[model samples]
Target: MFKNNNTCLAVFTGIIGVVFFSAKAVMVKLAYQYDVSPVNLLMFRMLFALPFYIVILFITRKKSEEHGLGVKDFIWLLFFGFIGYYLASYFDFLGLQYIKASIERVILFIYPTIVVILSAVFLKRKVGPVQILAIAITYVGVLVAFWDEFRIEGSEFLTGAGLIFLSALTYASYLTGSDFLIPKFGVLRFTSYAMIIACISVVTHCSLSEEASLSGYHANVYWLGLAMAFLSTVIPSFMVSYSIKEIGASNFSVLGSLGPVSTIILASIFLDEKFTILQMGGTIIVIFGVVVISLQKRRKHT
Candidate 1:
């Protein structure tokens, strides 16, 4: 009974985390209406969220001291932070400029498949037949989703989709690398330290980029940025980490299959994004594929 209760709680946490994470693209699209540059928008996100991460560090300082983080860990954290949060987020923000939020979410949903492939190739993990089939099904769904966008927007759609795919790829790399580190540093501490490094990297990029500007945005943009920082960025980051800690990554990912569906619904209502039956079908297929992959992972572990 206790185990069952804990599983339910973990599932709830994972679903909530997925929902908030899914909202990020919608929030970014909303902010774009104010003509905010992606770099500046990203800077605002990291800046607004910085204080929370600092507080986390302060709270965990003693615990981290007991763990005794080495210089190499710091270096790796910086590296993963740059690839995961900084580059992945920058590309995602830039990609949202050209693509619909719904489409972006579907594309980003492919990260798990990418993670599987990366693990197989780099980590030398064995790829079972089930995993291969799952990967194929997921990409087929992505193609279905992409078809409509391509028909409507043509070449520009490709550019935006490409950027988002790159974002997913980098993010997958981050996940693969973090799998090794998370157990060492612990989830919250590692996430906080790595995110702080990513924040600094983002601020530096904003400072250097010619297009980056802080001033002259409408009030709503700032509000949305704040919403994204707390609700989407900080809260979901910790929730997903905790969910993984509790239920393990595979189970959390199975619950995270809700992400694309929630994004589509939110985008339709908030952004007034329209989708066809075909797109909806594709989304379902993608989610199904992801669930298969997640279940396969669970079976392997068990």
Candidate 2:
């Protein structure tokens, strides 16, 4: 009974974490209204969130060193960190400029499919029939939702969709590579270190790019940045990690399917994005496909 209660609590935590993560899109859209450049906004996000990770790194300092990871490992961490958080985040923020938050979430949720394909291609892993079926279902849903946006939102929609797709691809690559290191460094330690590396990358890019200055935004922009750093990034990162520890990754992934649905509702409430039948239907299909993939993955592990 205690274990059951713990699982329930973890499930609840996972759901809340996913919802907070989804809110990132709405917040990004809000910040854009103040004419804040995407890179600058991303800089603000990392800047605000950096301290928390720093603290985590400090807390895990002993364990981090105990791993005995070599310079090569650190280099790989830097590479994946740059690819995952820095580049992926930049692309996501840039893409948000051209797409509605709802459509963007749906597009981003396809990262698992990307991961599957990447594993098959790069790792020489076989793509089973079940995986192929899940991938097919996922893309069909993506097309349904994307085509709906493309038809209504006109030509610019393609640009946004493409950027978001790039974001998903890079993030999937990060996951694929990180699989090798997580067991060595531990989740919290690895996450904190990688995020710090990503923070450095974002700051450097912003310093060199057109969005160098991070000043002159409205009070609300700074406030929203703080909110995103805590609510969306820092808090949910830890929460989801805890949830996965308690309930397992497979179950945690099931909760992830709610991400787009929550984003759709939040976008409607906050960003005034339209909530359409097509979007709901597409989201449902995507969830079904992702859940199947998640289950298949669990079966493999067992």
Cα TM-score per model: 0.86, 0.83
Model 2, range 103-215, lDDT digits (tens) per residue?
Answer: 88877877766666666676666667876777677667656655666567667888999999999889777766665666667778877877898899999898789747778
lDDT of 2 at 234: 87
Per-residue lDDT of model 1, residues 115-193, tens digit only: 7776678767666687567667766766775576646675678889899999988887777767667777887887897
Q: List the global CA lDDT of all models.
A: 0.79, 0.78
Clashes of 1: 0
Please tell me which predicted candidate would have the highest lDDT against the true structure.
1
